[model samples]
Target: MDSQADLADILAGEPERIATGFQFTEGPVWHSDGYLLFSDIPANRIVKWTPDGKTETFREPSGNSNGLTYDRAGRLIACEHGNRRVSRTEPDGTITVLAERYNEKRLNSPNDVVVKSDGSIYFTDPPYGVSEAERELDFQGVYRIAPDGTLTLLIDDFDRPNGLAFSPDEKSLYIDDTAHRHVRAFDVLEDGTLANGRILVDMAIDAQGSPDGMKVDTAGNLYVTGAGGTWVVSPSGEHLGTIVTAELPANCAFGDSDNKTLYITARTSVYRVRLKIEGMKTF
Candidate 1:
């Protein structure tokens, strides 16, 4: 393939609309079994769509979930906005609460989540799900849940922490602040703690979108949902370009057997595009 053509393969064609008519869609994840699962926040449920064009409900009253991912053991991990907690759905179809309170106060709302290879669960807690009167936490935070079920506050300085992901090597963690319109990187310490936080990218003041959800490819490039569409940034923080979508995307994930297909969850719909690059495997 021509070099340019090879690079252009990141998007096979116009984004294919898999389904529509949802109240609001977010948190798309591809299953190895040939289907994609995503959340319809306002509908309070998770929907599954197959490659063959089948759509069905995977779970109901999904706590108004916003983000979803699979753990090493194939359990479903979710960030619930309505319930203001992070939970895991076991293979046996049981739901287990992972994190809900910090220092005896209820969380503002768990907005996005990702699983580390070491079995640690990381998620962002913003107050988007509840009103100021119902929010018990004073500040938004990024939290980590250890394998032993211990919850630790990783960072609490963000105005609105929305999305999070780890570098391919797991040596760094990236967290985005919607209110600040910037993404920050942190060094992952040997003890599963984070330090050395710094701004990775500053969206231009005139940029069209605020930073929301993010994912990293195998090559360390970040696909972050922001103004105009998904902003693609190199591992070194260089602006590559943006993937424009018909609707504002909330989150994205690489799926398919090859992990080269990007599934996007936008308002009222879900879309997918085939990319030449593959996503970093969570397992």
Candidate 2:
């Protein structure tokens, strides 16, 4: 990561492994209550990590949860791969099914999710958790669940929509297609539908890994986990640098009180690295 030094203001220190021994880690979200939660996909669980370097099971048999985020109200919104639905974990610990089917057809697999400032929820549906015969939606899609309980298909042509995030101003939605090995930016229109879809960055130049999970900084820079590491791309779509990790990281989140710590969920371990920039939090 020679280019990393060019953006040294972003990376404060090298990534350090915090915890290990998980099946397949993904979906890292920082809670305001001082903890980091992430999914161990094949293990069917969600793990919580603390600043003390302790690990605990936040949820077992999590329906194979993938991506996770907190709504403005601080409630957990999750994409469940095994359950084929998007669920919300309420403050009282009761689970609410936000989105499970569209047009009376079951979803393929909700791979990742994000919450809008308007209380709306968005998620990507791909068939990574199930077989072809088990999938109901013929095409992978990016969907939005309105606060009124309406499910709307935002984009349906993605080859394999894996991860997604909204810009700081909520003006743009960035989604990555793992199959296509590229990230696409979409205009978040007034009606919550998308428009002006365009490729933001292509990762084909790096032959190591495909795009999976993504996050953005306050400066509008995108921290996408792919192409052999975490690609730090400028808002204008320039690949500025990379945070190459020992293990192939699947997802990342900004945690700690100041939101200056980046937590990465690699293959079998959780890693953390300091950052000079304050990352955008869930709320």
Candidate 3:
């Protein structure tokens, strides 16, 4: 599964522009109720796009949000850069601060997040959203929030931790480092901690941009946003192919009725392409 022909079996069509004219888009997620949500970092808003091709503002003064996901209860979880926190949008639309500090010190900046099957939350803490003078943490880390609301540092050696997702079976956790431009795999322990850290994909072999956000399909193939566009890599660490868009992509997600559409969040536009294989739905 490491060739263009292999990629052809997965991709049903080429990338097609769905929406455009955003200010640095990222963090795409599909809601069960319908519609898609993504971050416009510079614009500080979460824009919503419906099936009818209409786009509107989901939230403003988004705290300069960069990443977003939905919890099991259908609540919105977001990584806010300007606020340097990971927050959750409750059912009534009230904002709840999930994680803002660790060990009595404020976090550098929460970058991306994912929810495990057990209802715990996992997120990456990188300094990209903060300045050196204001940074509180010395190292970038991967953290887990227990179901009981406990925040624990799982990994603290990454240069700049970013996007992350779990395998279909939830036994493996894949996290990407933007500074190192590589993706790493970890064996998810019973206690929800990570072990056996190893490099899964090296983006240096590709074009230019670093890996930011990523998603996994049902077969465990990783659709990583990096380099030329979104890269499709096999579970065995092979680069199958790349999905190029009009603008360089920063993140992607699987959406639509059957979960067979790959939604990409490029620099200033959003793109989608049909896929023969369905994506791994966390919820």
Candidate 4:
């Protein structure tokens, strides 16, 4: 996926603006219900947009949510920045708090999340959502929530960890540090712990944007929000180029019936483009 032809093949057509008039937007997730759900952070709402151009509020006062994804059971798991916790929306429409504190200390802020096949949840906690005086934890950390509700701290050395994703085979985890402007890959052990951490990509010091949200395709190509636009890179960290958008994109996800549409959550609006490649299936 390093060649220009490969990049061109994934871009099906010009990116079209599907919705606008939002304050800061992030966390775009594709649902099987024929709609794309995203977070309007400043508005404190989650908005749903359909392919036919219909947009509506899915949830209001959304805890100032920033990142979202569906678990294997098709439940919506969200990273609530305002509430400083990770939550899951149940089938009965009730919200369940998954993780809020560790070692009796409140989390700084839950920023992004991803679930593993074994029913384990992984997320990044940074201090972006809260002020220094209001924070309880002294360091930013990456954590995992087990199926039995046990919370474990994976890594706590990051300056500001933001986005995270698993490899196509689920044998590796990739997490990006916003303050450092680099992405790191970690080996996923049998017990769901991370090890053998290494730098996968460095978004040059002079780059246009810092590292934020990210996703991977079925072929293992990483699409990360950084610098100027969405940076498309190979699994080994080769810079393939970027998918430019009108506004500075905050996050993105694969959507549509075939999972071939890349939905982007930019500063003020949500945009999308059809792609020839299919996104990695979580289920």
Candidate 5:
């Protein structure tokens, strides 16, 4: 367990500042092409950060892009909440809408997203971006956009499926239900459906606030963002410890030049810490 002193050092001290002057930020994705791409939600733009700490504009009026990931072809996939659809950023810089509706009814808002090795895009839909009465969908469900462009609902029972990530072996799926104040684990079936869901962690809503975004390390440890800080849960769901942050952390990713740095997005700043373990994904 990392002691309080160590946790303090991780949050405090000289931190890495990738850039500044952002209205609000979310959904950071590392591009091995030597740049980091993230959404400035309120600014309605996507910004890029070079390894040398230089900032540049990647896209304008990005349809309020939130979560992002690169497909097998290295094309950027984005969850556009404002547009109520998911899109792909092609190499030629053209945007392609992946999924926009279910059964002819418009989606609420696509929040966080993850891509399977098979090229399927899995994303969570919550009404956070839309007014309560404006949500056309009945429930905040998790949906999968198949490689062939078929939209399938994976599970529609979550109170609010906030952040999602697949297990190391892709046999299990973890989803954070902020309203429920717990993280649930489900069995990934052969056809990409989820079953046998059980609460993995019953967090105290008062202490931790609410679970937001998460990522799995190479060793299967789940690093989750919360109001208190970043909670590190062991593979078996043990509450290992928390990585304190200077401010309220909104989301986090495991990215660095060597892929061993834990990059955190606090309220208005981005910070990084060298980790003993590397993250599974490049970003």
Candidate 6:
């Protein structure tokens, strides 16, 4: 299938942000309450951006939080690289630990996360957020957190899984393995197990630095972070045109009233662009 699309067709023009002043940010999530929550990794805090452009701190020393998502209950789920765990922010702003260890060893670092309709949590763990010794886990893994608070290791073999997202139908999962310069796809099994893992898109060594974060649109188009800009791909692994921008984008999500706003987390700043294709969150 042809997976290429001109980003210019969907986006009316360059994005106008709702917030700013972060030190190296990543992981952006849009909530039903009309607020955007994101992480400033180096600054060690989670910040909120309202539709009116007001910004506020969500969490202090956020364990170098890298990714954010919301469960069915509207609670904020965060992937903390510094603490090497995934946590949830309660409605009252209190924090709750979701997963920290597996098989008696601490995780390397939870890099990104996404929630399923059934209240299951899936996340990627890499070593970028951990010290050499503190990361006890030998291999980076993609894990699942059941509603009952059980942790299941989905995949243990990955160079460095950075960002991830599920297909609109939830039958497929797309994951970014940065070091290998490729995005892999997995078939989601009936029991929430993943199988048939294969390389979905092989990124160029020079054209794209590394795929960091990604999002899928309503039509199953995949928008991923690359060196130059965002690489738009099809669900079947075809390469689409790049979403050109000033800064190197790290991650993205569909937000705004119609879910047509693509919020991107770049180097030290955040940006947004309108997309012709609304994101899967709205689909």
Give the number of the best model, judged by TM-score.
2
3, model 6: CA deviation in Å?
14
Identify the superior model by lDDT, candidate 2 or candidate 3.
2
- Per-residue lDDT of candidate 4, residues 197-216 (tens digit): 99999985565688899999
Q: lDDT winner among the candidates?
A: 2
Clashing pairs in 1: 208-227, 209-227
Model 3 lDDT tens row, 172-279: 999998989999999999999999999998998547799989999999899999887788988988889888887989999999888999999999999999999999
Q: Which ten residues in a row have the lowest lDDT in candidate 6?
A: 1-10
Task: Report clash pairs, candidate 5.
Answer: none
Model 2, stretches more than 4 Å misplaced?
A: 1-3
lDDT of each: 0.87, 0.92, 0.91, 0.90, 0.78, 0.85
Residue 133, candidate 4: alpha-carbon lDDT: 98
Residue lDDT tens for model 6, 29-88: 887668788899998998888877788897888898998888888888999888888999
Candidate 6: how large is its RMSD? 2.3
Better of 3 and 4 by lDDT: 3
C-alpha TM-scores of all predictions? 0.95, 0.98, 0.97, 0.96, 0.92, 0.94
Candidate 2 accuracy as lDDT: 0.92
Task: Give the winner by lDDT: 1 or 2.
Answer: 2
Per-residue CA lDDT of model 1 for 66-181, tens digit only, reads 99999998889999899999999877899999999999999998999999998999999989999999989899999999999999998999988988999999999999999989
lDDT of 5 at 187: 93
Candidate 4 TM-score over all chains jointly: 0.96
Model 4 alpha-carbon drift over 4 Å, by segment: 1-6
Q: What TM-score does candidate 6 get on C-alpha atoms? A: 0.94
Error of 2 at 165 (Å): 0.8
Candidate 5 or 2, higher lDDT: 2
Which tens-of-lDDT digit does each residue in 1-283 have in candidate 2?
4355666878999889999999999999999989999999999999998888899999999999999999999999889999999999998999999999999999999999999999999999999988998887799999999999999998999998988988999999999999999999999999999999999999986457899999999999998899878899989999988887789989999999999998999999988889999999897
Model 5: per-residue lDDT, tens digit, 1-283?
4322444323333335556678766787777766678888778888887777788888989998887778878889888978988899888889898988898888888888888878888899988788878778899889988888889998898876887888889898899888887889999888888899999986664564578788888888887887477788777887777777666666677676667777766666666667777677732
